[model samples]
Structure formats: C-alpha cells, structure tokens
Target: MKRIIITCCLLLGVTLISFAQKRVLVEAESFKDIGGWVIDQQSFDVLYSSYLMAHGMGKPVEDARTTVDFSEGGKYHVWVRTKDWAPFPTGPGEFQLSINEKPLEDSFGVSGSADWDWYYGGQVDMKKGENTLVAEDLTGFNGRFDAIYFSTEEGDVPTNDNEALLAFRKEMLNLTENAKDVGQFDLVVVGGGMAGTCAAISGARMGLKVALIQNRPVLGGNNSSEIRVHLMGRVDQNHNAKLGRIVRELDNGDPGNGNPDADRYGDERKLQIVRAEPNISLHLNTHVYEVEMDGNTIKAVIGRDIATNQEYRFEGVYFSDCTGDGTLGYLAGAEYRMGRESRAETGESLAPEEPDDFTLGTSNLWASLEREEPSDFPETPWAIQFSEEYHIDDHKADWQWETGFGNFNTIYEAEEIRDHNLRAIFGNWSYLKNEMPEKYSHHELAWVAYIGGKRESRRLMGDHVLTQMDIQDGVMYPDGSVTATWTIDLHFPDAENSKYFEGEEFFAGTKHIKVQPYTIPYRCLYSRNIDNLYMAGRDISTTHVAFGSTRVMRTCGMMGEAVGYAAYVARKNNASPREVYTLHLNEFMDIIESPLSIHNLPTLPQD
Candidate 1:
C-alpha cells in the first residue's frame, strides 16, 4: 500500500509538468500580416454568416461558431495576450475579449488593461482549457490584430479586472435583471408611422394609457424626412373630401393638395405636434421583437432598444399593427397575402390574368436640381452601358426608372430591388452630369432617399377583403368609409426596358373615377383571426388593384383614426374588436366626425 501511494504522487507530478509545457506563447512576432491571418477563406465564411445572423436578429455569431473539443477535462489555467504594438488602433480601445460568448465577470477574479505605449490588454478568465475565446471591436472602427498568445501561469498575464471593464461588457447585453418593473399600459401601438401615430394619439385622447413604439428616431413611416415621400389625401373643407384631417391637424391646418406636382410639407413637423400630446408615451428607436398572446388575443409586446439592446415589455388590452410592414400581424399568426391577385378571382378588370402577374415595383427616388455652373462629375464605369437611345435626354419621369419587375415576389424584398435601382440611378446620373451636352448639364443630382418607397407587402386578411370591383363599382359598405383621391394607377414591370419604356403608361386605362367618396368597412381594418389586434396603412385588406387606390398615406391615416378609436371603445367596454365593429358602428363614425369639427373641417358623407 505504501509503495502504491508513492507511485501515485510521482505520476501526479509528471502530469502537472506535461500540462505546464503545453502553454501557447503568442508574442508580438506572431502578428505579421494579421489581417491576412484573420480574414482567410475559412474566416471569411464565418464572418459572412455572422453578418447574416446579426442582420436577421438571430443568435450571435460566437454562440453559433464556438465549439469545444477536449480529450480530457481538468481545471487548466488559460490566458490570452496581444502584441504590445498592433497594426491598427490596438489596446483597450480597439479590441474586446469575451469568454463563452460573454465577457469575463469581475467576480471571477479576471484582470485586463491597455499598455501605455503599446496595445492595451489585461488578463481575464482563469477558465479551464478548451474554452472558446472571441475578440470583438468595441470602437465603431475596425481593428487589425498583430499577435495573440496563450499561457498557463498565475503571474504570467497582466492583471486588471476592475468593475468598469465588467460593467462595460455587462451593459452590452443590456440585461433587464436590475430594472424595476413599471407595470403595463392599456394600449400599446407598435409603430410610429402615420397610422401608428394617429392610433396612439387618438387612443390616448380617449383616456387610455398609450405607449407609442417607433423603430426610427422620427415618426411618420414613409412620409418621414428619412424616406421623403409626401402625404397624399383629400381635405375635409372640400365637402367631406378631407381624407387626412388627422395629419393636417397635426401639421396645424397645413393643406395637403392631392396633386403630385404640389409642394407638400413633410410629415415629421406634424409628428412633433402629435408628440407633445399629454396621453402619449413616445418610445423612439425601439423595435418590437415579439408579441405575447393569450389564445387569439395579444396580452403584451416585447421590444428592444437599438442602441443598448435593452428589452422592454408593455402590457395592454389592445394593440395596433401600424408598422406598414404588418410586422405585428405577421407575428400574431394573422392571415396575410402578398403579390397580385388573379382577375378571375376578384372579378375585376385591373386584376392580373394569373396570380403570378407582376405587382408594383419600388422606387429609389433622387431629386435633381438644374445647376448653372459647369460641374465636373465623375463618370461611373457602369454608366457606359446607358445610351441616348433609352430616352436618356428626356428629363421628365413618369415612374420610368422604377425597376425590380422580374426579381422578387413581395415588397418585403424592397431592399434588394432598391440596391439594383440605386446602382442604375447613380450610374445614369453620372452619365447625365458628365457625358451629356451643356443644355442638359444644368441637372444636378440633389438628394437620394435613405430607403426606397415600398409599394406592397403582407396585406392582413380582414373580415372583408376589398376587391377591385368594389372600387370600380364605387361600392360603399354600411359600416364606415375613408376616402382616397388617387386613381387606380398601375406601372408596368419592365417599364424601363420596353421599347416605349416598357409600355410604361401612367394612369393607363382608368381615368380618376369620381365616386361619392365611398366608406371603407370597419371589417377591413382588424385581422380576421386575431381578436384584439388591428392593422392600418398599405397592408390593410385590399385586392392588388384596389390597393393601388386605397394604399395612399392619406387614406391609411384615416383608416388609422377609425381603427384607433374603435380600439379605445373596445378597451372601455371590455369587448373584442369585432364587437365594436358590429354593435358600435355609429360610435366609430362619431369619433371621426367629432375630430374633424374640432379641427373646423366639414363633415364626411353619411350615405
């Protein structure tokens, strides 16, 4: 027994010596051409996948990529060290190190710091072997690594695991563990677009606690200064023609002329006026992540701040999907359809012969100003393909540059189409400015919009799907109505490519049909299956052709007002949205009528 004990002690000493010798010594010399090392073919694949995941709001790359492979498990001391001098901005400012996809906790007795003259770094994580390590750039700027080494010795690494470093990484995750619960509100509007803004303000005016969540810094979705699309609707002073009184009132009686040629004031200034309302709690730069539902009814909404990634929950009796994209409706399992409807199905003349027919294309608009100076613009190498044969000299635009006819099926792919159109816009602009004659030289590109204006997306399936026939026949539902002034205009898919600019005729077959300012049914606002949820904007129930007329922002804003008031009534009565649609139709109409009078506008047609 004594001999066996002595033999076991000797073997333990040998194992310790072997583990000590396995240390990885990364030094300054190992960092030569660091970019080449980190961005190799294998690393490129990893990076590409990481970007896709991040953009999709999926799991972090480190969680997906890190793997542990160990033949034996034991407590092995591990440390990472970078070169004293880095290729780029090195030290604490350039790189952030994380363990197990999380930053090392100070409670774990980790340490780190930036070296004064060289790169900054300190020791962290006295973790066991086979642990995953990740280095990220905390500074918005990219960093180039020089060298990194790992050693297994207590005093070998620089120790500086202070509270500040721990807090820095802790804040990145933005965990709400320490945040006090603020309870919930009565109504939560998931978008700050035109419809959403109206929904929150109108609901709040009804004395409900309303929370307005806007993903962007500003309100007014498409009409936002960021996108630059003008609000289009009728004014009430024209004898019930005022389709966008909500926005106009917010704009302080700023008249919105329906003509595209008119100088329409943007929606942001109006949004500011709405933001000052007492009952609305505006949460800007917050995006809705998910909707928590109880059966068919939504109980609460989960949102996240884009800057801090801190999550927030809002409990409410009712919710409105004014995101324009119908995000909330989609999340709540509401039935929706995208693309064109077959003419046979809707029994309308404008409907496509087949369901596969092209829908409206997105536009990447750029405003051009006539310049007097002899401007020297750089010629785009891709612009050589464009020639004068394509009517490049005819400066007038009737939506000719709108591309993406054959590419995507739904407007959700607007970004992809916008990228294609942006290339074309920039390429064409370069030729016009550089190659065109002096007579055409005055036109200079002024501004390109931040995002392309989307024409269509997941239209929520409502109790009544407004067909193209409804518009052509000027059918009025018994419930209520919102008026739109735009004609049933459809643009050809290949307008730019056709011999006559792809047979691209604006306001093609139908002239502006003067109907009696028909009312849109309340059934068309809320989703068919979802109990307490409502949808507004371009994504409401409508056939492809009907949408072309009703999808205008002015009509959308009216739809928002109607549905918003309905939601308030539903909350007050402790009833579902459908109940309000059926039993309290007059109350809904009264709300729309009363607000117009308060703004000193004419009453809408009751018939």
Candidate 2:
C-alpha cells in the first residue's frame, strides 16, 4: 500500500507538470481596457505585476477586459491572485472573475493573505482561439487584483516566490531578455515630482539631452493633481532665488489641499513646460525598476510602462535619483539609511538615543463638500472601526492625516501603510455619514487621494550628510547652492490619537524648532560610492533630524536645480559629480546665479 501511494504521488506530480506546461497567465496591467480602475504599483516588487485598484467610491466600477490566446480548448481552472482586503470575517471588497462574458461559479478577491495569494475561480469551458477575461468589481471598496492564471490541470499552480514568479511570467508570456532601447541622454531623471521636473527642465535649459521618467501619468510627485499636496516652504531665499523660477511656473496658485477638482494642481502647466523643452524626453507612467551598473558607475536604467508592459532601457551619462525613495541609487548599490539614528551615532538631540524605525508617514488626504440635502455613504464593514469616543469629524483632510510611522518600513511595507490609511478614511467617512448623519447630513466626501503622498524613506548616503547642527549654525559650503527655509518641522504620532488607535494612529503631531534659512551644500546631492549618480528630493544625504527642514517640496525642488547645474558642469567638462563639486565649484556657481531661461516665473498675488 505504501509503494502504491508513492507511485500515485509520482503520477500526480507528472500530471501537474504537464498541466503547468500549457498554462496561460495574463497580467492585469497589460489589459487592453482598464475602465474606472487604476494601476497600483506599490506592490510591484512583491507581486508579479502592478495590480488594479478600485478606489472606495461605493458604486461598482467598470470592468477590466483583455483578450487571451489559448493553446488548448475545453475546461480550464481560473485562479486570481488577490486579497480578502480587511482580514476580518466580513470582507466588503468582493469581486467576480468572468471569462468569455460568463461569470465564474466562485467569487474571487474575497480571500487571501496580506501579501498577494491566489484564489481559485472554479473551472470554465473555453474555445481554442481568442478569449476574453474580465475583472468585474462587485463593490468599489478598494478591491485589488494582480494577475489571473488559467490552467488545464487543477493541480498546476504558480509559486509565490519573486524569482520563480518572475521567471514563470517571462516564460509563459515569451518576454524578451533585451529591453527595448528608449533613447540616450546626458541625464536621466527617474522622478517627475517637484525635484525631478525641475531637474529635467533645468538640464534641458542648460543644453543637455535629458530623459524625464515619471511613474504617474502627470508630473509633480507629491504636488501632482493625482496626490494634490500643496507646495510648502519658501523658494524666494538668499541662495536659492535663481533655482525656483521653473517651480514658480508650475504652481497652480492653489493655497492648500482638499481642492474639489484635481486640475487645481496644474497638471497641464507642468506637462507643457516639460514638453516645451526640445532636449528633454518626458516618459510619463513609466516606472524604473532595474539599473545597469558598470563598476561604481551606472550605465543605463530600465523602466516599464505601468499601462502596457513594454520595457524600455534609458542610457545616460549622468542619472538623477529624485525618486524620493532613492529608487535608482538603491538599485545601483548606493549606501543609504532609513529611520532614526541613535544619539551616539548622529549626536543630535532629536535622534532617539537608540535607533528606531520611526520615519514620517504617507498621507492619503481627503475632503468633503457640503450640500443642501443629506448624502448617504455605503456601509464599510471591512474598514477600520471608529466609535463615538474615537472618530474624526473634519470637512477637509490634509497632510496631517498620516500613518506608517514605526508601524512598518515605509518602502518594504508601502502597500500596508497605504491600505491602512484607506481603511481609516473609509471607516471614518462611513461613521460620519452613518453614525453622525445629523452633523454630516449635508457633507459628501468630494475627493480622497488614492495615491498617498509619501514624506520620507531611504536617504542615499553622500560625501556629506547634512545634520541639524548645519541648519542651526547656518553652515555654508563653497558648493552651497540651495537655501532651505523651512524650520526643523519634525513629525511624531499624535498623543491624543495614539490613545485611541495605538500603533495604528493616522493623525500626526508636528514639533517645530525654528532655524535660520541655511544654505544646503552640494556635497549632499551625489552618491558617495556610486560615481555618476546624483540625488535630489527627500532622499538627499541628511541626518533624519535635519531632513525635517530640508524634506519640504520647495527645498527639494531647489535641490533639483542644483543637481541639474551640477550635471551640466560634469558633462561639459567630462568629469564626475565629485569632480564638478571639488574641481569646478566656481563654474557650477556661475550656472546657479545665471538661471532664468526655461520658463517664465508667475507673478505672486500681493497679500
């Protein structure tokens, strides 16, 4: 009987392998039509592809449909890689998987792990030719679906390991190893935020061929219409006045977040500026994930379109990692640090005597519009629970509605942080509309940011790490080109909110320490080990305590300007970033003082 059991197990394994050989996998992001759904790249590293996210708007969204070529006919088992969403018994975010216009017997997206896992969709009959697959969302309560698998054998399942999953995807899809060459440039800016947009524009104006790669469809990272973060901090300063003319051109004239319309963030104006530049090639919705490293220098960076899965390789002499998260620099093996430092390590008062994972959280800002009639919100049973004792009753949500501090690593656990914020937003909004309808009778949730605005993560180590001492004493380097005007505005979990939510506090408390407007040295902008890499934005070399002041968008934008000028000087003289700082500081300074070429500065309204 034991020998028979072993023989049967071997036969079953052989059958599973045979079935797996003929399986077909469809990447959700590569779907032909993704209506009312958006690509969620927060879990790209963990998941096979960027998944489709349905923002919690109550009503069911349009389905994502794609055509697939099947090699064999007959019944095939359908599997969807998704999550149960809330981890509770009642999962509000449930969706159905349909094939060839027929709905599957079992409902998908209602069960799985915190990370992605597969849910079986029963078996469906299919023709040998072309077939259509649809992700029909039942409730638009932020249900996510990564990819779908169809196999002739029920036992053939895809592995969850990153390498195995990636290899399976490539082999099944017959993807090419060589990435499609996009173009060559003097500089390739990885982000399209305030810093990256400024860097691209500045480089183009300085007569360098530039490639601006933005992960989103629009520019202005945190300040974009998608995220809708109001640009803060000062730009009109002593050393950085020349660095912000381009930033001024892109400002939407809007003062704060919670704007009714996304257009108030000025997506068009930013796009127009980048497009007007003859030398800058702007590739929006392209996410850079891989880097080609040659020794200590980077040769090319590879990116994929989030909409279509087409990969592109961008070659450049110099690279600017304005990706706030230090994405490119990290990919190229650049030294970096995350979280707080010990007092013994940095010797700063703000440094937590012992190191801790306590970085500022990302914000999923929201707002409401008041109407004459009562507005009804659907019950969010799967969302976080907020009682009368602990509920938020605000008409507008802004940067303060934050989470992820010490709860998780901001980069590795980004999806968890964003989902936690979403749960809080939906839960609180539901409470307002349902529990306290009298007070919120006329208020309707107008806009909730699907893309959370991130504050800090992965500061790339550079030749010089700016500290709070530098800001306090107004230390100036010969290569000091940008002035940081924001005070030491560090954030911690709100004590009041923590009492109710403990480790899951969404609101933030800021402690501001005033400091003189200090000049930021250029040495903090380039990687110490990576030769050709330059960094801007929040990821610039800085102690966690000092990042409080320099992490603001305007300060980061000026940092981008400095990076652009440095890139030009490095390329013109055939020198590295370090050489441009040490050997040719004066020539770089000349460029900083003589900028005003790219875009016309908008006139500020008099107070």
Candidate 3:
C-alpha cells in the first residue's frame, strides 16, 4: 500500500499519491462505471482531456461511481475540475459529489468560473482501505467535470494551465511517456468519416493492409446517427466511374438531416463492412492528436482512447488526413489555410472582398417528435431567449440551424459553437411551448446533436490549391481524378437571424453558384510539404471558394477512394505521395479507368 500510494499511481493497484502528502487524482473519464454520463471529447483538443457529461437532455442522470483504495485515509481536501457552461446568474447544470453515498459539502459544476478550473469541495473523511466516489447530477442540463483530486494538504491544488495540466495528468495516471505501439500497417487512415472509411475499404480491397481510426464510436462522421447529416454530392459523375463504387455501396438511404431514428443512419452496416475487410484494423473512439515525424515523413501517429485515456502509437508506411479539421496535417507541421480567401488571392468572383475569419460554420442539428399528451418544459433563462416574431418555427432543426461563423475559430472554439447551437435549440423550443402553446402543445424535443457537423476548417495546403476558376472555367489538369458535381454552396448567417442576434447568429442562409462537372486534380489530395501524407474530405487542399463545392460527403468519399488506389501505386513503386503523381500517374490513372464490381441498387418497377 505504501509503495503504490507514496510513489506513482498504478491503475490496477488503486490509489495515486504524492510523497509528502497523500493525494489521488481520479480522472472522471476513467470512472469504473459511468451510468448515464456520456464521455465527451469534443473539446479535448483545447481542454487537454475528455470529461464525463450529464447529457440526460433535461432529466437527471444516473450516478457515475468509482472505487478508490489507499494505504492512509483521513480528512482530505477535495478539488473538482469543472466550469459553469451556462454562466447566467442561475445555472442549470448543477451536481453533487457523494462519497460512499454520503453527499459532499458543496454542489459542484454551478457557480464556478466559466473557463475550465478547479472548484474546492470542503474536506471529507475517508476509510483506510477502500472508498467509493460518486457524481450525482441534479439538473441534467449538461453538467460536466474533468477530474476529482483528493489531497491530505489543503492548499496543494492542480495547476489550471492546460499544458502543465497535461504533464501532471500523465504523472498521476502513470501514462507512458512514449506511446504504446499499435501494430504496423501499410496505410493509417485517421478520421473514420465517409472519406476515411472508403479509403480504408478501397485500400484493403487492393490488397493493402490498412488501419482506420475514428474519434467517435461510429464510422460515419457527420452522416452518423450522432450528428444526423445526410450524404450529399453526386457520386459516379464524369471522369473515372470506378471512383465512387465504395461510396455508393455504403449509402444506406439518407434519412434526411437531423433524423431521430438511429437505425436510419446504418451505423452497424458501416461497421460490418469495415470489419469484413480482413486487411483493415478499425480503431474507433481513438483520437489521433500527436504525430511522430521522421524528418519529412510521418513515422507514426499517437492517439488516446476517449473513454479509458489509454495512449497508442500507430506506425504506418503512409497516412491520410481524413479528419475534417485537418488535425493530422496540422500536427505534422503541414502548411494549411483557414478563413475565406479574398478576391485578389484566388481571382474568384464569389470570393469575399477582404480576407477575414468568416469561413463556413458548423451545424449542431436538433429534432422534435409530436407526442399524444402535452409535455412540460422548464424555463431556460440561461438559454437564448426568443420571441414569437424572431423564433424559427420549425418542428425539426435542419441544416440551416448552424453557427461558428464570423471570427469564430472552428477548431479552437468548437465547444462554444456546439453550446451556442444548443442554447438556440432549447430557447426556441421554450418560446414556442410557452408563448405559442396551441401550435407546439404536443411537440417534444426528441434529439439534439452533441457532436457538431463541421463544414470548414484547416485546409491542408498541397501541390495545387483548387480554386473557383479551375471548377467554373473547366481548367483540366492532366492529373484530374475524382469528379466534383455539387454546386459551389457558400453559407452565411440568415439575414433574419442576424437582425436578432447580429454577431452571434445561429440560423444559416446559402446561395448555390452552379458549375459544370469537373474532375478535381490529384495534386490537391496530398500534403505539399509532408512527404507521406495524403488528404481527403473538407481538409483537402482547396481555396474557400473551391471548398464550398468539394466539402460534400459523397465527393469526399470518392477522393478517399482515389487516395487509396494511389497508395497501392506508391507502395509498389516505393514512392512518396508526391511521386505517385509525378512518376506513377500513368499507372494510377489506368487503374482508376478500370471497371469495378458495382453493387446492385434495387430499382422501382417500370410502369
């Protein structure tokens, strides 16, 4: 007990402690049983860690409990890491910390600093052998906490500095300084979106060993049940017809945006298809944050398990940045661009007059179902207040219900974006139910996305950045691969929404600039600087104007398929991503032109 407690903590051996004073740092995410609390890693990039969230959707959730054993136990100071998400005078996210079923002195997660920090919970007496710690949610309005720390000394507290906090967490949790080695693969495809999934499948089908890593539990990114966004863009357009074979196979019929039915998204079908591929190693709920660079090439990528906080190192011959935010490329020091491009920069008609941070926003969609009986919704003053005239009077929130525009850094301020969307959803619903009762008497909120469907972020620069002129003017590159057919759809705050909440608008409006089908150049698929990196999806090399057309899921999926086939050429020739185009373009294009076994789509009976 002394050896384990006095020194570094052993997870199985139980208590973590300091030498001078007995201390234990219990990560809330590492709790033994998180009954109703959902593990949230949405803000891990900014916050440095995942936390337990009471996402009971306005109902009190079940308790999250863990057992702790220590050599010496007495009066110990308790510190909880949390924030007041709704920082109004009265907060809705209120929770209690109970030890061995006895409630702690303080009601945590309410009346605290808006930023992530430690909140003091007055000292508690403990037994010498084993004790239980529980977090009981009171309000169910998204109460959250990072970790709970117990110390014999009163003043010794964990640092609020996120960077320093990372080091401290590693020490306390006994996390390895070096990432634990995951098995080697021919290609490591980070981000299990439509693009990355297709990449893995296409690569595996071509007899290449692959690893597909996704941050969420499901394979589909935005199209998954968690986010409920439909797959857009026309697959099997002009150019190589073989490119979209895998994407068409994966489409299980779009349920439309914000569909409440989980089965409609075909989560298990995507999982089964990926699992059926013997050559793929599917890693879900694993977020790749650290990049191991071997000079110009990426040697391996380091990821952490959101639930268990276990670190793993995945080594690969080639890597793909399918992460919509371009997280992988950014980590490898790949040159990337964000925000709208000015007219002078891209020479595009639709380009913004001046370069600013007004990039396409993220959407956190919500939906409601009508019930037979009338339901009661509590007043949410913390949420955005809406009136009859200003309120969006839809039964379900569609793609237009969006945010994260105008100076909002979609990557850094992701959590705020989602929260803002939530406030908008709850507030509008509240107004309708209370103010206009007759219209929405039977309507009840069914689902609201916790995971935001992001449209634009870091655009990893490649050999050539696809511009609006290339698509509209039909400038054909010799290395043209995947065909783009979706309209150049650019989004902005709805004029009516802006009139109500000017700088912080939630509703979105878009204008579609039509363009003829054009093949996207292969040059825009891989990183320009990083030797082994290939990219697909929203993060692919494209100016803001060009990305407006290329950001759709079906198109991105075809891009992934193209990258996969190219990887086969790279592996056979022992070439880099750049060389695949410069040297092996002929061979790659020949393969792309070949016919593929198409899946049978049941057609309607001819009348």
- For model 2, the superposed segments whose C-alpha errors exceed 4 Å read 1-20, 596-607
lDDT of 3 at 498: 93
The residue-by-residue lDDT of candidate 3 on 356-415, one tens digit each, is 887888898888899999987888999999986788788898899889786477999998
> Which order, best to worst by lDDT?
3, 2, 1
User: Candidate 3 — which residues are off by over 4 angstroms?
Assistant: 1-10, 13-15, 595-607
- Predicted structure with the largest TM-score when compared to the true one: 3
Residue-level error in angstroms, candidate 1, position 503: 14
User: How many Å off is the CA of 166 in candidate 2?
Assistant: 0.8
Q: Across residues 402-519, which tens digit of lDDT does each residue of candidate 2 receive?
A: 9878887788778888878888998999998899877898998777887878998999999999998898989888878888889898888999889988988889999789988898
RMSD over all Cα atoms, model 1: 15.1
**All models, RMSD in angstroms:** 15.1, 7.3, 5.8
For lDDT, the strongest prediction is 3
TM-score of each model, paired residue for residue:
0.66, 0.94, 0.95
Predicted structure 3, TM vs. truth: 0.95
